[model samples]
Target: MSPDLWSFALAVYARPDVEAACLRLQSAGANVCLMLCGLWLEQRDATCDDRRVHQLRQITDPWDRDVVQPLRALRLQWKEAADTDPLLKGMREQIKGMELEAERALLSRLEGMAQGWARNSKESSDWLEALAGEAANLNRDALRVLRVAAAGA
Candidate 1:
């Protein structure tokens, strides 16, 4: 696995079924960035706690809502039209790039927030499950895919 969060996320995302599973979790209202961060924490053997989770959420929620979501919505909104119109397709692709940039920025912020934490001396915390909360319950298979992918990554 990569040392940095962005590279770590890319590696995990490249694993088989990982993208599909992440999309499923995202559709189910899980923040893909948060999930990736959780996996990163798990890999680092960092202990999960309520305060940390809440702190992460505080950093994530607004940025995702205000920055990423709008870009994504605009890009998705142009999907069908962009399929037929080359010009529209180009613009939509740009929006997609912006969305990715936004996500990458979010991951950086998450990494910064987590950087000071020391690794646990004992067993690893289930950051994925703790971070996912009820969303994990709703998307068990998807979550499982992520866990397997993260393990491989």
Candidate 2:
């Protein structure tokens, strides 16, 4: 991982829709960095962390799948809008960048905790709890960014 991995993660984490989608993915048993990285890689047309991303991609539960679809769709929508509108495009790119940087920053600490348990282990409930804590922090940071962005507008 690069030294700026956290920066990359934070870039993605700045987006409200991205953050919300990630929380939904976390609620559905996906790791936060993996989820955000999946979106990042998808946006850049690069490869994802295949094992973790693949596991998420293979989720068969309808409820879980449904929750993530909005995330996937939001990424596409943001990407598309970002490519077109000159006015909002810069902000869209900023949000995507923050999302990635936030994930990278937060995951440096969290991934170690996440790797301790087996993928199919019974630690999911606990993982969800931990994720909620992380999500709250991310949400708070995002809200601050939103306030600044809104105030500047």
Candidate 3:
């Protein structure tokens, strides 16, 4: 059976420098969910191209903007208070769990969208490039780190 998106995401994000790389990419206007999906597709040897990347953005942009980002923002907003208030700390943790669930749902949707895509023999590096194209500010060093980590995976 094919690996599920959540599990794949967990494994990839656990890799050395991957989380940092993803955060860097996210700060540069790239969607981390899309980046995770790109890595999953690469692991599956699926074709990665501009059209596919566009399709991924269309599938995820709304959810990210509507659900995930709000949860994240709220969690961050509560961080200061949560540090001092025990009750707020628990609430913040709950919000963090919800945010994670939202991301999982997004990954599942992405997996569904790419379900019928034909697999190819393209190198995983190509997939990173395709996803990176969406980020206007991802620097060369960051891209190199991401590519190396992804290629190693």
Top lDDT hit: 1
Candidate closest to the true structure, highest TM-score: 1
Give the per-residue lDDT of model 3 (tens digit) for 1-153.
Answer: 138878877777777888888888888888888877777777678877778888888888899999999999999999999989999999999999999999999999998998788888643336666776646354556666655665565
Candidate 2 global Cα RMSD: 16.0
lDDT of 2 by residue, 49-132 (tens): 335433433442342345434444565577767777886677666666655454444454433323332333222222222323
Query: Where is model 1 more than 4 Å wrong at Cα?
Result: none
lDDT of 1: 0.92
Q: lDDT value for candidate 2?
A: 0.44
Backbone clash count for every predicted candidate, in the order shown: 0, 25, 0
As a TM-score, model 1 comes out at 0.96
lDDT leaderboard ranking = 1, 3, 2
Q: In candidate 3, what residue range of length 10 has the lowest lDDT sum?
A: 121-130
* Cα misplacement distance, residue 22 of candidate 2 (Å): 1.4
Residue 47's lDDT in candidate 3: 76
State residue 63's C-alpha deviation in candidate 2, in Å. Answer: 26
110-135: candidate 1 lDDT, tens digit per residue: 99999888788875577888788778
Cα misplacement distance, residue 56 of candidate 1 (Å): 0.6
**Candidate 2: residue 79 lDDT (0-100):** 77
Instruction: Enumerate residue pairs that collide in model 3.
Output: none
